[model samples]
Target: MSVTDEPLLSVDGLQTSFYTEEGEVKAVNDVSYQIDRGERFAVVGESGAGKSVTSLSLMRLIDDPGRVKGGDVTFRSTSAVATLARKFPEGVATENSPGYIHVTELRSESGAVGSDPGATVRDNPTDVATSLHDGSLHIEAGHVDVLDASEDAMRELRGNEIAMIFQDPHTALNPVYTVGEQIAEAIRKHLEMDDGAAKERAIEMLERVGIPDAEERYSDYPHEFSGGMQQRAVIAIALSCDPALIVADEPTTALDVTIEAQILDLLKELSNEEDVAVQLITHDLGVVAELCDSVMVMYAGKPVERSSVEELYYEPKHPYTVGLMSSIPRIGDDRERLDTVPGTMPDLVQLPSGCSFHPRCPYAEDACLEHEPPLVDVETGEPVEDPDPAVHSAACLEYTGELQDGVDFDVQIREDAATDGGESV
Candidate 1:
């Protein structure tokens, strides 16, 4: 698992939603991004902005009523090819290694992707390995939609290949189990180590995460540890396996500034030492400024902008991003009240027809109210269904010059607090 130039993870046209008594609530709209091996990618947005949901969807942790409707989550791995080879002992005929697996695990019941008439994946050997034979997937470069894998395969993939750190360490941890026991459980289950070895490794991980007196603390229950200590334990469990990708859902939100810094620094260290990729989900742009290589801004469940962290903060192109920056307090600000977007996030179930943020955008015009703009390169502003995730892009009519009276980002900034460290936010 050495880091390579090729992308380790790529998500395309991802859409996840919840089915309610009223209707389908699009929690995560057509979001797409790709992260390279060992990269720290940040997804920033206010609460209910689908930041957490996106991560949860990637982990396939969406509970009943919430389903990942449309999307492909591809992860590069040679081991995954072996996993597929084992899963499709009879049906799949792979020419190349399964270098990438679409971890979503498309179910055989998800219609065409897995249950095709010619390639139906059935329990019996007589059945076609239809799950891996998605007409399009030849398994070259190991790119196979994981949505086609079985639950058993997905289980093996979770802690071993992909891991997650929840927002609240207390809730994520089992109250009845000791901190070390839980870590050992994960180790034993994923790594298949014996109890004695697993416990020893768990202690080693605890110490690695800066836990003091690791052996003694191994017997301490979750309630016994302080808030910061609990978070450290969570990180210990997450990193114990050295997963290829770790989706950290606001990992530092519950900690104090000092602890937050320590946790962030620890994550940075692990990213380098372990060569693990991280998808850091948080609303704090300051944290993104500190830890991430690239940033994606989400609004009302849709990606409004994405770019390198410097470009995102220093030269934001979307109006929503500008509004978010205006809300952040700067040192020389003279305004009596803090700047905030005029309106709150729209109700997901009853989202406006066109651009969801049009109501709150000062530059919004008739066109914006009628037709939502696709995310596009700010320089070209040409409408693109799926813009390059690595390039600077935004979803706004102004980018395409549709709005005659386009947004003047200057209006959102004060004279002295205009840029952050000479960057645009």
Candidate 2:
């Protein structure tokens, strides 16, 4: 899709929570973004930063205690609307289709029954057509929202339109079934091929992912294959349906450095070859810089900053982003102490009253504790030359002009006064 075009998937105000025995844990909170066709989007954060939850919400795969509270996920197709209209007419509707909405016309037998008489017949048609054309028709294309679709409809779209490669290949793959059988099952289910054809296709996919002796290894169990092989098998299964979008949730987490590099290369190659958009979820900044077109730095279940991978690595905006970048160990640095972000993640059940990261942020002031800062355009008001208004954003009181003139050094003063016989500054 072109730069001016609507995103293939757009998520707005997404909130997901789980009702635990202790309390409701907000896994994801009002997270939003847009993914263009064939773009590599990465969600980078520490573990439990809601990266996986976001992906699960997109697939409607959250179950049991987890539930989506509020959100709008809108998906736009790259294919022309005329083509989709041809395949499925304006008035036509399918019961099992996830994003299918029907438009009904009421024909009055008598002209006397005129409701909203001032409105022209053309106006009503236009409104209804617009709603049908753009408002409701959404199917999740990977992490993108396919709108107006029910659970059943989403199931149909899941593997066919959007596929996922989970973090753990061993658990994700069926232990009892042969590797070939599992792949063939996915192929048969999504591709609607017969048993023989599905098996053949499965073998072809294994070969495509660089699994040696594909035909021989198809019948091997999950335990029989090595970690790298299992991961490759999982990739083969995820790509079997030729989905438009793929969610790789730390696909390299379980592998060695060499294997991880190989897997990353493989994914990159597949993304280019198949023209499929990828969402890579990981905490590794190096991986984000290497593979992602755009990077979203999340903290406390919220995106603290977002920018192009290059900009984010080279010129981070938020203090949290800067801290994360600084935490990355250098190859030849001989410093006694490596820089580290202070404090642990706050309890999601009872988050801080104001900015969630304020407790850990060294630059935080009293204003940060008074109220949460809104994510906004930094350049319009500030005299400082900010690059790419849309590309960078930070949710911090320091950037929002709410910071106090002087730093609040209460903790440092207390420590100093206790250690030395000096009055607190």
Candidate 3:
């Protein structure tokens, strides 16, 4: 699962919503995107723009009331799980080479053990301790609808294949467990590693993630470490199995700026060297510009613009996107005020009739308030071509010939407030 030129994961028509006492809040609507092997795809938006929810939805980690309304999250694999799974005999994970059995790969279909994707098990392999942490039960999900993948498959798939670096390390890392213990537990669960070996590997991973005094500090509780160190430890846990994809949801949220820079550097380095694709969910456009290869601008739970990082920054086509760009402070630039989108993001429960962003968009008109524009290429106003990395798509009425007064991208320097008041003596 190193580097390949194929799309490792594709999400289509994803709809996620939260049910409240008042009404259903659609957090993600018709979201679709894909990340190729080793690509760093970023999802950027304001606080409630559904960046985090989209990531959670991809991982099937969304909790109750926040159900996946409709979608397909297909994972492409080349029989890796099945191949390694064959090494297990009667559910007992073999002591020798089993490529990597992330979370007990209890055979999916025609359950059997062998070093082949087509190997059939004598029976549903659950009775094998590999099947359960218990002997009385069995678990398996019959489909790839990640939201509904069997509890066993998901448990293994999580840390084994797709791992997540959550926003807060404090809540993410168990307070009661020793830092090393948690990492070792994950390693043991996903890999065919014994206790002693798993502990050693955990220490190694901790060191690999740049934690200092790794061996000695393994016994320390989460509270014992500094903020940066805790975050490093969390990264260690996520990388324990060398997952193919990592969903980093504001991984730098709590850290100081310096620490945040270090974390981002580490993630970028890992993605480049290890060929691990990252789904970075963030509110910082600067971070997106710096770290992401491609960027998706989410607004009101829908993707309004998507393009390679360069196009998104310099050739932005969406009005909301342009406003966001004008908000970024430039070096050695003198401006009285930064551009801001007026009004707040809409309420998802009662999202505006047409385009949710119409209320805040400067270019919006009656058509924008009545008919929502689909995500289309800014130049052609057509569906985006998969191979065109330069395709800049935005959901804006201006591109669709519906916005009477389109966006004005001209530079308008306002008079300095104090200066406009009159000369002072």
Report, for all candidates in order, the number of backbone clashes: 15, 6, 5
lDDT by residue (tens digit), candidate 2, 1-425: 33225466677778889999989898888788777777889998878788999998888898989988888775554232212232334322333333243222222333221332112222333322222245222221112234445565566667767789999998999899999999999899866899999999999999988899999999999999999999999999999988878999999989998988888888888778867889999988778766778877777777777778766665566777777766776544455676788888888888897988889988877778878766644443242222232456667666667777623322112333322212111
TM-scores for candidates 1 onward, in order? 0.85, 0.79, 0.82
The local lDDT score (0 to 100) that residue 10 gets in candidate 3 is 76
- Candidate 1: which stretches are off by over 4 Å? 1-3, 83-141, 384-387, 411-425
lDDT of 3 at 249: 91
Collision pairs in model 3: 86-114, 111-121, 112-120, 112-121, 141-150
* lDDT of model 3 at position 128: 28
Full-model lDDT for every candidate: 0.78, 0.69, 0.75
Could you tell me how far off, in angstroms, the CA of residue 150 lies in candidate 1 after the best superposition? 1.6
Q: Give the clash total for candidate 1.
A: 15
Candidate 3 residue lDDT tens string, 246-276: 9999998889988888888989999999889
Model 1 quality (TM-score): 0.85
